[model samples]
Target: MNTKIIKLDINNKMYETITAKQGDTKSRFLLFNLLDGSIPFSLENRSVRVYAVKPDRTEVFNDLIITDAAKGYCILELTTQMLAVAGTVRLELMVIEEDKKLTSNIFYMDVKESINSEKAVVSTNEFTALMNGLAALSEYDIYKSNAKQVPGIKEEVSNLSSQLDNMITLKLLMDIDSTNYRINDFIMVDKITRLQNIYMANFLRNLRNGSPVTIACMGDSMTYGHDVNSEDKRSADTTPCDNGSRHSFTRASITYPESLQKYLNKIYKNNVTVINRGYSGDYVKKGMERWNKKHNANLTIIMYGTNDSRADYVPEEYRGNIDEYLKWYEQAIIREILWGKAVVIFTPPKLQSFGDLDVDTFANGLIQLCKKYNVPYIDTELFTINYNNINSDGVHFNGVGYEIFGMKSASVFVSENLLKPQYVKGGTKLLNRQTVDNFVVNGTYSYSATSGAYTPSELNNTGGSVLNLNPGSSITYSFYCEEDDMFVIPYIYTGADKIKISLDFGLKAPENSIDASIGKGATPLDNNKSSLEFTNSGTLLINKDEVFTNGVECLRIPTKGWHTLTLTNEHSQSTGGTLVINGIEFMNYDVFASYVNINKYYRQNYLKYTSHPILGDTASVSEIRIKPIDYLKLHPFYYLANTEYWRNPPLQLIITDYLKGSIIYTFTIGNNSDTTMFHGEKARLGAYTGGRTVSNITLDNDTREIVITFNSGLTNKSNLLLKLV
Candidate 1:
C-alpha cells in the first residue's frame, strides 16, 4: 500500500488538506509527522489526542498511536464515521503533557464519496468514554453555576448542555455491532502484512529475473562464524567485520555469509552476495546501530539475541528486562521494513555453558514481536537442538556447524518462494530505459594491476568525456530496470588495437573468466549462446574511426530489479591495450500500456490528495513528444506544492507516452519559500525517449509554472501526448 505521510508544523496555522475516500475504514491511514517549526516534536511521555469535526458538524475524538516517539510520528486509521460524509472535515491535534498542552492549528480532510453503500457508523470504546466524561463535566458545570448564581455561567452551561446532549445522541446512534468492519480497523495487522508482501514480491521478482540480490547476515559471534576454525576464534575486543570492511581471521570465506552465498548459488542460477555484518560481543542495540549505518541489502538475516541474553548484558534504558531488549529488536525489524527491505528474524541458537542467561525469554519475546509485525522468522534454537555437537565453545558455532546453519537458513527463502516470481494480478507495463555513465557515482571499479590505472582522468571521444580502463582493469555497475527483456548497449571507443569485449552478469573475480552458460534462465539475443557473454565468435567489430559508438548489444536482461553489469578489459598486462567506455544503456521493448490498470490500483489503495500519473498509455500512436508542462501534468503530485507535505519526496520520475516509449527524469528540489513554484530547477533526462528531446526549461514567474520548449516546433500539442505515469 502507498501510505500518505503528512508532515505538519504545530506552530504554523496554514491549513494543509489531505483526502480520503468515503467508507475507507482500514486501508487508508494518515501518518502524521508532528513538528515544531522545522524540528520534530518530542513525543516521549506525551499523549496525542485527535479531535475532528465532520462535514455535518458531528465531532469525534480519539487517541493516536505513536509509531516513532523520537521522530514525532503518529498514525490515525480512518474509521467509518470519520469518512462518512463526502465533504470537508476539520481536524486538530493536541499533544498533552502533565502541566501543559500543545495544540495544532486546524487542518482539513476532504473525503471523496465512494460507490459502496454507507453502513451505520460504529463507535469505539474510547469515543464512548470521551462522551460520557464530557457529559458529566457539563452537569458539574451547571451545578457550580446554579450554586454560585454567576450571571454568564448559566448561559455557558446551557450551551454546553445542548452540545453534550447532541454528542450523547450521536454516540448512542453509532453504538452498533462492529463485526462488519475489518480487523485492521482496530489494529495495524493488515498494514504490516501488505507492506511485507510488497517487499517480498519485489524481492522475489528480482531474484527470478536473475538480478543481483545482496543479503546481510547481522548478529553476534554466531553470525561472524566464530570458532569456525580454532585459530579464527575472536575475542571480546576484536574489531567487527561490516560488509567485508577489514580482513581478519573470522572474515574468511568459511563464514556463514559465504556458506549462504554458495548454497544459494548452487540452488538457484543467480548472483547472491551475502555480507557478514556480525560483530563479536554485539547485542541488539549495537546491531541496530550497525545496520542503520549501512543497510543496502535486499534481505537482512538478523540473529542478535544470544549476546543480549547474557546476564550482565543489560543497557540502562532497558532496565535489565528481557522484554525491553525485545522491544529494541522489534524497533530494528520495523526500521528494516521501513527501509524497503525483506527482513528475516532468527532466534539465537542454543547456548551450552552460558550461566544464568535468559535466552529463552529473549527468544520467545522475539517470536512474539515477529508475529505482531508479520515478519518471517526462524527458530534457530530448535534447529540447533536437532544438530549434534555443533558448538565449539558453548557460545560460537564451529566450521561444520556454521555451514549447516547457513544452508538451513536459505531453506526459508526457498520454501517461502521468496526467490521465485509471483503471479501478480496486473497487466504487464513497459518501463523507461535506464542508463549508466562511465562515472556512475555508485559503480565499483577494480584493477588487477593499479600501476597503469588513472584515478581522476577522462578520455575525450565522440560520445563525450569517458573513462579509460587499462589492461586487466574492470568496472562494474549495478542498476535497476523494470522489464526483463531489456537490451543492454555498451558504448565503447575501440582504439587501433583489437580490443576484446566480455559481458558478465555480475562482478567477476580476477581468476574467473567469463562463462556464456552462467545465465541459465536468461534469454540471449543469439540463438546458440547467452547474451551475457561476448566472444570473438559472436562479436560486433567496429572500425577505429567510429570513435565512440554503441559497441554491441551485449545482453538481454532476463528479469527486473537490481542487476550488475561488468565491463572488463579482456587483455593481459603484456598486451597493453586501453579500453575506453563511454556508457551503458538499457532499452525497453515496446508493448501496450498498462497505465489504466496501474491507475485503478493506485486509486483503490492510495489516498487521492493529488493525482500523480504513474504510467502512460501507448495504445496506437507511433510517436509522441512530451514537454516539461506535459511532465507536470503527468506528475502533479510532485510538481504541485502538496508534495512538500510528503515525508519523503520522490527521487526519480518515469513518464511514458503513446509513442510506446518513456523517459526517466531525475531531479532534486531544494527548499522553496513559495512551495508551489519550482524555479530554476533542472531535471536530467536519463533515458531514451525515441524521437523527442527536451532542450531547455523555463519557468514563468507570473504563473509560477514550468514552460518547456523543445528543439522541434510545438505546433501540435495533441500529437505531444504525455503519460500519467
Candidate 2:
C-alpha cells in the first residue's frame, strides 16, 4: 500500500481519550487512526503500538490489531480494558511506502480518572525540579553543606526566576538532559542562556497548548549528527563509535538533534515531540523521496547545501554556479508548502572557503528563495561569522558547537518575544516585495511613435488610472538605482495567449553602455554575465487581477547607475492588444546574514560603504552615514562597483497594523544627501491594498505623510502599501 501519516489523531477528530474507572472495571471503547489509508491498505505489513502512563505506578504498552482500513483512516479495535487506564495514552502509527518507513507524531489520549481525591497533591517548585535533575546529572552531584550546587547558579537562577512571569526558560533548559541524555551525553548548563526565539510564535503556541506539532530537519552529515568517524549512520546513531575512547563526547554519542529534543521537552513540559528524520550523508536531492512520502511536519528547518561544493555533489546541469543548489531547494520547498507544511530555511554558516564554493553567492540566493516562495528562514550565516574554531574539521561541529546551535535555535524561538505569537506563521505572512516603497515615478519620458510602435496611455481598471501600452509607440522609464539588483514590473496582460515584450535596459553613460540586444549579448565586464536585455512574457487577459505576477522581468543588473527599462511591444501580434501596467517593483533582495557579515568586515576594517543602500522593507538598518573612505583599510568586499550584493537599507520606516483605526504615518525623503528616498518623485501616497482599496486614506505631499483609515478593525499583522503610477 502507498500512504503516509497526516496527524496522529483518532477518528480524525479526537485522540485515544479513555477513563480509568474504579477497581478493575473498564470505561469506554474508541476507534484509532492507526496507519489510516485509502484503497484498504494490506494489514500484513502495518502495525500500531499504543502506550499508556497511569495515575498510579502502572503503565501499559501493546500492539493494536488493525481490523480494517479505508478512506484515509484505519480502525483500531480498542477494548474496554485498553481504555481502562486513567492517565495519558500515547499512540504511534507506522506505515511502509515504497520501501521507506514513515512515522507519525505521537497522538495523546487525554484520559481522566473516575476518582477525585479531596486531599491535595504536593506541588514542586519548577526550579526545584530543574535543580534536582542538574544535581543528579553533573559530576558535582552532591550538595556541599547539604548546601546547594553553587552560589552563583542559585543567585542567578533566583534573580532570573524572580523576574520571570513563568518558568518558560527553565522549562526549556530542563528537557535538555532529562529525557534523551545517555552516559556520554550531558547538559551544558552554562550554554543554556535565555536565547531570543523571536520568530517562533507557532512553536510557542503549540508548546503552550500542549498540541502536537512536528519539527522536521533535513540536511547532510552535520545534521545527521555524524561524529569524528562513523559518518554514514543516517539515523541518530550513537553506539558504533570507537571515538568514545578518544573523548567523553565524540561523534558516536552526540547530536544537536537530541539536544534540541531536550530543549523542546523542557519548554513544552515534555509535551512536544521532535521528529528527527535526518539522513546520513544525504544531499537535498537524495532526501527528496523520503521527505516527500514520510516527513510531515508543522515546521521544517532545512540545513543542507553544506555539501554542494563537494566534487560529487553538484548536479550536471547546475555546475559553474553556487545557486544551482537552490533549483533543487526551490522545488523541494514548493512541494513541502503544497503539502500543507510551513517551512523555515536556514543559510548555512560560513565554511572554510573551499574551492569555488563561494558562501556569499550561495547564501544570497537562498534568501531569494525565501522571498521567491514566501517562506521563513533563519540567517545563521550571519550569526556564525563572529565565532571561529567551532568546527571539528572544516565541516562538522563538535559537542560545544552543536550545543551552541541547539541553544541558539531555542533562543530564537523562546527568547524575548521571538515567538511573539504574531510572526509564528514565520515569514510566510511577509510580502516578498513591498510595492508602495519601491515605486519609481516617471510621468515624462521619451517615446518612439513609429509604425506599429507603442505609446504610453492610461486605462481604467478597478477605478484607477492604470498605465497601458498603446500600439504604434514605445515608452521609456528612467530611474536611479544605488546597486545592481532585480526589478519586477507589475502589469495586467490579456492578449491572445501571452504577451511578449522586447526589453532595453542599460546604463545612461556611454562608457557603461549595454547591448540592449535580444539576449543581453553586450557586456562591459568581460567575465561577469549581466542578464540585461530580454523578451519578457505574461498571461493573456484583457482585464485581469491587479497583481505583480505577469510583468516584465529584468533578472540581475551588472551596473549601478541611472538606468532605463524600455519595454516595447515587439511581438506586434500582441501590439494590437496592449498590456496594462501598474508600476515596477524593486525586489530589495539581500541575505540578512550575509549583509551583516559584509558590513562587519567593512566596519572592522574601517572601510567606508562606498555605495548606496538598496533600501526596502523587512531588512532595513537603523542607521545610515556617508563619509570619506579611509584608503588604507578598504575591505575588498565593500566595493559597490564590483560587489553584486549590498548591505544596507535607507533610513525609512512604515508601520502597518491590522486593526480598525486610523494611522498617520510620517516620512522624510530629502533629509540627507547620503541616501536616496524610495518612491523618488513617483510617490503615490495611499494604503496599498489596491489603487483605492481602503476608502479612507489621504496623502500630504507637502509633509510626505499619509493617513489611512479603515471601516473595520484590521488584523493584528497587516501590510500597508503605496504605489507609483
Task: Indicate which candidate wins on lDDT.
Answer: 1
Q: Which candidate is the best by TM-score?
A: 1
Candidate 1, residue 24: the lDDT equals 70
Alpha-carbon deviation at 721 in model 1, angstroms: 89
Error of 1 at 491 (Å): 51
**RMSD, every candidate, angstroms:** 28.2, 29.3
Least well predicted 10-residue stretch by lDDT in candidate 2: 424-433
lDDT of each: 0.51, 0.39
Candidate 1, residues 511-630, lDDT tens digits: the string is 111233323112213221122433332333332122112223345444443334555665534344556554555544221112212322232211111112232432222223222222
Error of 1 at 558 (Å): 39
Judge candidate 1 against the unseen true structure and give its global Cα lDDT, from 0 to 1.
0.51
lDDT of 1 at 607: 18
The clash count for each model shown is 5, 33
* Collision pairs in model 1: 209-559, 613-724, 613-725, 614-725, 615-725
